[model samples]
Target: MNRLPYATVARCVSSLSRTGLYQGVDLRVLEAFDLDALAHFSGMQPGALCAGACVASQSSPALALTSANLRWCPACMAEGLHAALFQFSPITRCPTHNAPLIQACPHCGKTIPYRLDPAAVATPLACPTCMSPLVADLTILAHAHHIVGP
Candidate 1:
């Protein structure tokens, strides 16, 4: 699945564009947003109800937005929006043999393998039994090296 929903990609690009951070060098970081990893980037808990109206109208309760601190942005509403719809660009994964998903369970520190769905990039991948969120140490695509502006 693609990571960094298109919306966030769009927003990141727009944010960079507006802030003048969008240079050729940043494309590498942008390319890192693939359907495989993007679904986990929003930092939002799935299926949680959003309480405001500023959120994108199409967001699902499971895909509600959260502050960088991992708390809900109360001032913002959680309407049904495609998480990817907010990004200005698309996240492309490397064509190399699928990299191993190396995430650890936040609760247990257990290793979790990653898979690139190329779809469902907005959904979280949890432990098969506990459904715990897995923290990953991802390898940024080489192309992404150029996309993240200094």
Candidate 2:
């Protein structure tokens, strides 16, 4: 991945500096993919995929939805894929596999961090605390659905 230019960093810093609320904000936060910013920076029009934030923002009296730390579908991980929906707190199960999404390492019982260091051996597919591969357990899936009602 190409590092962001100094000018981009300076611009972001300058903007944040004016706000005075977020002092010492890490520059790495800027590298996180933002659909709106990406569209503006690339000079390409954002499409339907860009509506995620809007959809997430809409309120409903019946459903109390909130964003959570990164969670993963182990089956998806085994297939080398990550679904964006798993990051939502209200989504407790993987739609594709009918398996429960895991937020913490089964071994270490620590919540997964939002971002993983690229240089670290601990990947999104593995537990940062125990370095154990995150995989789906069918037994747990059976128990989960029985309690939660699938």
Candidate 3:
């Protein structure tokens, strides 16, 4: 994705709000494409994509406000995609990969930026601190899976 200017993003958000496209939902959680072209561009059912983006408050415990630094599982990152659920504070582990999500870079101890610029960085998994790949140790993943019990 191209790096969009803040003004452009703001304008898009305002336009969407005016249209009531995202009624009663926080627009911050969605990416620019999701808000603008997801329904038109993707072949997947629009309902599935839309529903997956927002979680229902009644079904789960109240979530903590997302920090500027987001957390992610390195294993999941290796798949070349980031999961939206990783931004939720209550989600500590990757259910599919059985690995704990990491917020800070292991090498430089700096927090990963929540919104990554694909143009500036080769991939989202690259650490802004050490420029190293964000990979979790196998033993650590195994331990997490054992404790979390699938």
Q: What are the Cα lDDT values of the candidates? A: 0.29, 0.49, 0.51
Q: Write the per-residue lDDT of candidate 1 for residues 22-110, one digit (tens) a residue.
A: 22212212232232233345444322212211233223332233211121111110211112222222212212323222234446665
TM-score of model 2 vs. true structure: 0.48
Q: After superposition, how far is residue 26 of candidate 2 from its true place, in Å?
A: 11
Of 1 and 2, the candidate ahead on lDDT is: 2
Alpha carbon lDDT at 111, candidate 2:
76
Tens-place lDDT digits, model 2, residues 120-146: 232435576777766454234334335
Question: Measured by TM-score, how close is model 3 to the native structure?
Answer: 0.53
Better of 1 and 3 by TM-score: 3
- The parts of candidate 2 lying over 4 Å away from their true place are 1-64, 116-124, 135-150
Question: In lDDT terms, which candidate is top?
Answer: 3
- Go through the candidates in order and give the clash count of each: 50, 0, 0
Question: Candidate 1 — what's its lDDT?
Answer: 0.29
Candidates in order, TM-scores: namely 0.19, 0.48, 0.53
Candidate 1 regions off by >4 Å?
A: 5-103, 117-125, 134-150
Residue 48, candidate 1: alpha-carbon lDDT: 26
